[model samples]
Target: MRETLRVQLWPLPTLGVALAAVAGVGLPQLDARIQLDPPTWLKTYLFSGGPDAARSVLSAIAGSLVTVTALTFSLTVLTLQLASSQFSPRLLRTFTADRHVQATLALFLTTFTFALTVLRTVRTGKDEQTEFVPQISVTVALLLTLASLLALVLFLSHLARELRIETMMRSVHSATVHTIHRLLPQQQDTAGRDSAAGNASGATPEPPANALPLTVSASGFLTSMDEKALLRAAVEADAVVLIDRTPGDSLVAGTPVGVAWPRPGTHLSSEARARLVGRAAAAVSIGPERTDREDVAFGIRQLTDIATKALSPGINDPTTAVHALAHSSALLCELAGRDLGPRMLHDDQQRLRVVLRRPDLDELVTLAVAQPLRYGAGEPAVLARIAALLRELAWTAPPDRHPPIAGALARLRSTIDGQDLDDTEHVRLVELTRLAEEALAGRWPPGR
Candidate 1:
């Protein structure tokens, strides 16, 4: 019942009752004076033998009562209509949608209500016939004017703030999206181009001048060759080759591998080539085939690209890119027959182990170790040794032993005091030290 009254009948009825009570109190006195009426008691009290002031007072009171009741009823109806039309849900939503505007409106309404009460008191004097039309009109006009000014200021301020926020959000969102897009491809291309350019520069001062650029596809005899021997042969022949290994191809311990580039006008007899291939085949034990080398290489390239892009300023930490490179390096080693086994394959696991056991083997350490070696030594002897140890570890060790290997490598890094050696010599020593550590940890020796 209370809910129903609150929702349906309370507000308008209360306002009406209040208006009626006000009219009843003020109008009677004013009307009595206007109509020249007096009550019988009042006439006796003032002048016992004179005209009947009671009649004039009563007539004025009745007339004023009628006028005031009619005016109040008209005003109430008009107010309700105006409220319904101008302050409809849709219009009110638009007006009070802004917090500032809503606050200003509340202030104006409160002031107007106070002003109305003041106007009523000042205009309704003791005389029953006194008119309050001017005061009422002026009060209403003042209220409306104040409301208009408040609404205008609030609406303008709200619109300006809204526009500013929207513009800022849009600009920031666009910039972020655009930056990400631009950076992704740029990173990929940058890494690829840099690698390709580095390879093209052919800056490594290594021997073996009869090098041919050999490109081997996956479905060839190259898949069956011993990776170590192939790399050695390539180094001997001064050849640059791309080896494509199918994912999960079990590599035998000893198999002839790699595409060979014969010297110009110095083609080898098939028998001689076969002999070289057979000798090359006698090197390392192969693993169970799981993934293709080409696919692995492609994945590594993609990851490298992503990392490079993510490393851009304002995108992600540069260490992220370095970590990516480390992961790719590990994968590439495996694809190139230098696997670190399954346990060390995952970056997080590998990183955790490195952190707990070999904390010195951070991204910076890897970069410092890898950059000079990769760039300075092209097909160096130490690299071959490192590659051979990596292959041995992958074949022999369990997945969990990667941490110890990482620890060993870190130990090796610490041993290298800062010494002023030539670039090639320095890189060679670093590579040799790293390979020795890997071999010692994995219980492997040269030619094992």
Candidate 2:
């Protein structure tokens, strides 16, 4: 029920439906008044065609709207199915959020409903009563019908272009980049902090075994946490909270979502403990499926799906797999230069209150490349393409984040079988390997 409400309130659908209903309800009142002194241009047979003509026009529009609305829905559903089967099913969410398609559907429905409502007002010479013509309503319906036709054409054109592989890849790339920006802002380098903390190089000892574990209330993906709320809860309880799960992690009921511990030599009262646990659980939200809201891993999952589909035995398209790799490498490059896997959060009073777990750049790189790399091992062209992408990422990434690329290169080397490659293929493979080696060591060191 909650998910259904969320879907209904999604901005694209909500706005479209709300606007259509508003037009249906309000436009008739405007017609009732405006038809009394309709323009000189509308005084002709075209606009002043009495009750008979007005009913005919309204009926024509209402009937045509039904047909056009069905056509719009049919085309949208068919295209989405094709795109999902050919590219990635995750992209269905993108289509649902699209404003253009939603607006087209909204306009058609509004025209149909508006025409039908005004038709009810067309009292067609019953008992020889005074004939009435809703000139304004008929004129508006005609205009709406014309606008809907234009929108239909635009929708068709947009759908045709959107189904292309390149277009889908670009859309996924843009969304993942946006998610990165929101979830992983660049961090200041830690040189000064490192210098000061040199003596504290070793890992901190674990908390007391009796520390309070904030149990997860449900099983789902950890979509997001309210940082400020968690901080306040910690401050009020005079404790520190360490998050066990981050935005992309899966959760199960009864598992520890996080830990809350008082400062050394301090303890939480029973009442405080209960309140703190409740607040901690309230600070986090879980959902059945991962959301793009802040989960970078979900974005990686979409790219992985595209690559997996392309490499399947039935499809056997290494070129598409290569495209996915190129974009994945680019995304990894952008992340490599940014601050990742940091654990501290501070309150307004400048006290540390919360510690979060984050997936580091290396983990993200592996997640994005692993599945495709595994499936493409047999295709020499696929390996060559993967090598080029690895080279690009290593070259473009900051010098500090290269070990993952080196590791990937090692993995690629292990996957190659000499029996499968011809002399020509071996020569090309050697060149690609040299390129990967240079990318890792030329700026960034191996096995860091």
Candidate 3:
């Protein structure tokens, strides 16, 4: 729920409208109760108009704000369209999640609501009633209008900056980094090193002969999971739950997403198995779209999308592709120092209860490299960036983690070999490949 709200546009604006409604309705009543004598200078800032003039002023403000609000919405939609077409459809979330854009729309709508609400309170003497005007309310509406105007100017400038490819890539990078820190903890503790054998690092553990298949209830991308619930379910059933699907994996209804097996020497009953299946299914969340909340690969996929789009013949923007690769490289290097294996959850008894699959370094490296290699094979600049990426990852990776980088580096070499580059470009690429190899060998700066 939090992840869904974070990437949405309506929450902020809707809250603004509700607050504006309260202030609009409540402030006038307060003005009606309290009377004040103001100095000439103070009165100048306040609304000094008659009921007729106040009505005209409020009406103008409300009408103009409506138009401005419409314009802001139109511009936002247009930006979404351009981002979808020019970059990747996945990038639309980045623009929608922008707080600045959301706040600007909220400001516009708030002002409009306030103006209209205050406008209705302006009363020119009728039916022998005394003439009334909400001086403070009208004054606030004026100030809000001015603030809205300033916001309009700032929003236009912000939208322009956001349209740049560099800015977009940086936004994706920053958001992905936040997701990484939130989901993938650093393996600085010894306990973190105890990855299941044959699972991710060591030999794979086989399920019990009577292990039961666990199927998904819905068809969608596996977005997130409640680990505690899974653990509880496993403990109650006296079994180990192995989740075969990770965040960002597409799940199908009635398809086995994992397996549940009873602990060694334990007999399984049908009732417990049914309860475990229901609880486990409830603990996992599936959505139509992938979110960065728990899925590190989604970010890499977005970056790769940007790189491939830039490399397309229609765009032919090698520089942009290189920039995207740089971001991907940074993410991959960060992943290198962390554990990229199946996450094991244990009960209070120190027994493993749940095992969740995650993308390892090899899978992520390929995700970040494969498309660019295939699309930008002929571009020497793109090839060099990929080589630099591998070198950087190699620098931070442990010896065991070097194989994925080496595999990617080998592919880089093969791509370079296939490119019809001149002697100069070919040699530069070869030098980069050599540097990457040296880095993998625990050597840096060659002679140093």
Count of clashes, each model: 35, 0, 4
169-274: candidate 3 lDDT, tens digit per residue: 8988988888888777675542534333212233335787668988889999999988888988999999999998889999999998899999888866989989
> Which numbered prediction scores highest in TM-score against the true structure?
3
Q: Which is the better candidate, 1 or 2, if ranked by TM-score?
A: 2
Ranking by TM-score: 3, 2, 1
The local lDDT score (0 to 100) that residue 447 gets in candidate 2 is: 26
Give the true-structure RMSD of model 1: 30.5
Candidate 1, residues 94-143, lDDT tens digits: the string is 22223343344333333333333333433333466543333222323344
Clashing pairs in 3: 197-203, 198-202, 198-203, 198-204
TM for candidate 3 is 0.94
Provide the lDDT at 262 for model 3: 90
Clashing pairs in 2: none
Candidate 3: minimum summed lDDT over ten consecutive residues — where?
A: 195-204
Tens-digit lDDT track of model 2 for 1-448: 3333433314544564566556655766666776667677656734667787788888999999999989988988897898789878877766766668777887888788778877876776789865566666678789889999999899999998888887888887898799888666565553234322111112333556888999878899888888778878998988888886778788998898988899786789999999998888888888876667777767677877888899999898888888887788788778776656545665556556677777776788788778887888778888887787788788877777778888888887776644378788877776787778887776443421
**How far in Å is the alpha carbon of 53 misplaced in model 1?**
83
Best-first order by lDDT: 3, 2, 1
